[model samples]
Structures are given as structure tokens and as C-alpha cells.
Target: MRYPILIEEGSDTTAFGVVVPDLPGCFSAGDSLDEALDGAREAAAAWIDAALDAGMPVPSPTKLEDARRLSGYEGWTVGVVDLDQALFDDSIERVNITLPKRILRRLDDLAAARHQSRGAFIADLTMVTK
Candidate 1:
């Protein structure tokens, strides 16, 4: 998925700013164009993840041409950030894994303490680490 982003050019004394129009309130900044775009990608991914986790629908990206025509952002440079399609996928699949008995026990204990299922606990941990 390629999401269109608007970048405000930066000067020596300022940082570049980027905004992901598809995802409201998702924005990022950096000292250079590359850094700004990278930050935008991360911001967009995090925005999608949070929306999915909260049971909210993630908006599809508006076409680059259409996004460019939107009001405001007049003079900002336009660019596309290619996001992994998997970021928008929320399907669940079952899998089997082998773990040391002690580790399994500890995992179960931690999950129980959090009042979450083992799978839920693992998923939460994976997201945090990512």
C-alpha cells in the first residue's frame, strides 16, 4: 500500500515535517527528507496498528493525484510511502510452537497475571517489541 504524504521543506534552522493524510493525526518530523519519510512510515504503521487494536476501521489511502488536490498543503512536496500490506491485515491464525517447560510455565503465569489468554499475551508482547 502506498500512502501519499505531504512534506514541508526544511531549512538549516528547521526540520522537515510530514503528514499522512489517510490516517488522521498521523505525522512525523526529521532533520532531512529521508529521515522525515522514514518517520512517516513508522507513524503510519503505528497509527494503523492502534486503530485496528481499538476496533476502528483504517481508511484506505486516497490516490496520489486526488490527495494532491486536497485543500491546504499548498507548496508541500508530495511523496509516497510504501507500507507492507500485512500492516492492514488483522486475520488470526493458529500455530504450534515448542518451548522449554520452564519458559512455558513462566509465560502462562505472566499471561494469567495480566488476565489475558496466552495468545493475547504473546501478541501484546510482540507488538511492543516491534
Candidate 2:
């Protein structure tokens, strides 16, 4: 899954640094943004390999709340990314279904009003309906 990468922007020792919260101890650094990103990719690869080897739970990316907690780290600011969508897509399933024309139209209207897709509307309805 795509875990959030937190780049601490201001550090005296490192110009750029990456921390993959999902992968404990998975961290890398560089003197520039490009280098930092490269380091993060390498770190992520090694992190995944080790996790697989140890049969450990791979964590999803850290959220804003988690990143905000790192504010205590001196001279560091967090940067989060949603770049790992593909990794997490497996967590959900996709299904197709047919509905009556009138029901479909009603679903479409409801979805538009809620700014959601018909599928999403159906999902929400399922959750709240008996």
C-alpha cells in the first residue's frame, strides 16, 4: 500500500530527508529534493523487502495526524504524498450491476446532489439501510 512519506524540510544536518512511517526505521536523506526522493525510493524498496522477509505487517502511509505528531522533531516540516494509490487499490473490490431505468435515474440524481457516484450512493445506502 502507498504509505505516506514525510519529508522534514528544515534540518541542519540534512537538506532533505524522508521518513516512511509505515516502515519503521525506513528513512533516507539527501542534500537536495531530487536526491531525497531517490533516497526515499531506495529506502522504500529495502523496507518492503525486509518486511516480506520477516513476514511483518506492512503499514499504510502515515496520515496528516500522524505526520503532525512529528512536529516535535527539531527543524523538521512534514510533506505527505498520495502517490501509492495502486498499492492500496487491492483493499477494495469492484463490482458491476444492472438497475431498472427509473431506479438508475433516481440514483443518478441522488448521486449528483451528494456529489457522489451511483455506486458510492448505493454503498452508503447499503450501510444505513436494513
Candidate 3:
């Protein structure tokens, strides 16, 4: 998903500010444009995660042109923050895969040590690495 963002140019004394218009109350700041945009992506992800956790609906991204027309962003730069759709999906899915016997044994051992199912262990690891 690509969310539109409005950037307030930073001055020597201030950091660049970013607002994700599609996500209400979601914003971020950084000393440089690159940092600011990166922050925006992180902020959007966190916002979506929180909303989902709270059982609230996640808002879809508005078009760049539409976001540009929103009030109070005049003179600010416009950009888009791309997010991985899979990161926000919480649906459960079952799949089959083949693993080497040695690796499978290690995975089962780790899951047992943590008192978690093999699927839960893999899911937890995936989230942490991501």
C-alpha cells in the first residue's frame, strides 16, 4: 500500500516534519528528507498495527492529488510511503513446506523449549526478523 504524505520543509533550526494524511494522527520527523520519509513509513506501520490491535478499521490511502488538495499543506512537499501489505495482514493461513530433517529437528526443539507450537514459533521468528 502507498500512503500519501505531506512534508514540511525543515530549516537549520528545525527537523523535517511529515504527516500521513491517510492515517489520522500519524506523523513523524527527522533531520533530513530521507530520514523524514523513512520515519513516515515506520509511523504508518505502527499506526496500522495499533488500529488493528484496537479492532479499528485501517484507512485506505488517498490519491496524491487528493491529499495535495487537503487544507493546511500549502508550500509543503508531497511524497508517498510504500508499505508491505503482508506486514499488516493478521489473517491465519495454513501451508505445507518441506525442510531438511536436521533443520526440522532443531525447529521442533526450539518450539518445545519455548512451549509454543511449531507454527507459532515460526510466526514469532518471522515478525521479529521483519
Best by the lDDT measure: 1
Q: Write the per-residue lDDT of candidate 3 for residues 23-46, one digit (tens) a residue.
A: 999999999989998898989998
lDDT of 2 by residue, 69-101 (tens): 765454555664434444323245788888899
Better of 2 and 3 by lDDT: 3
Q: What is the C-alpha lDDT of each candidate?
A: 0.93, 0.69, 0.91
Q: Candidate 3, TM-score vs. the true structure?
A: 0.71
Q: Report clashes for each candidate as comma-separated counts.
A: 0, 2, 0
Off by over 4 Å in 2: 10-14, 81-130
lDDT tens digits by residue: candidate 1, 2-57: 99999999999999999999899999999998999999999999999889888999
TM-scores for candidates 1 onward, in order: 0.82, 0.51, 0.71
TM-score-superior candidate, 1 or 3: 1
User: Which 10-residue window in model 1 sums to the lowest lDDT?
Assistant: 61-70
**Pairs in steric clash, model 2:** 3-61, 4-61
How many backbone clashes can be found in candidate 1? 0
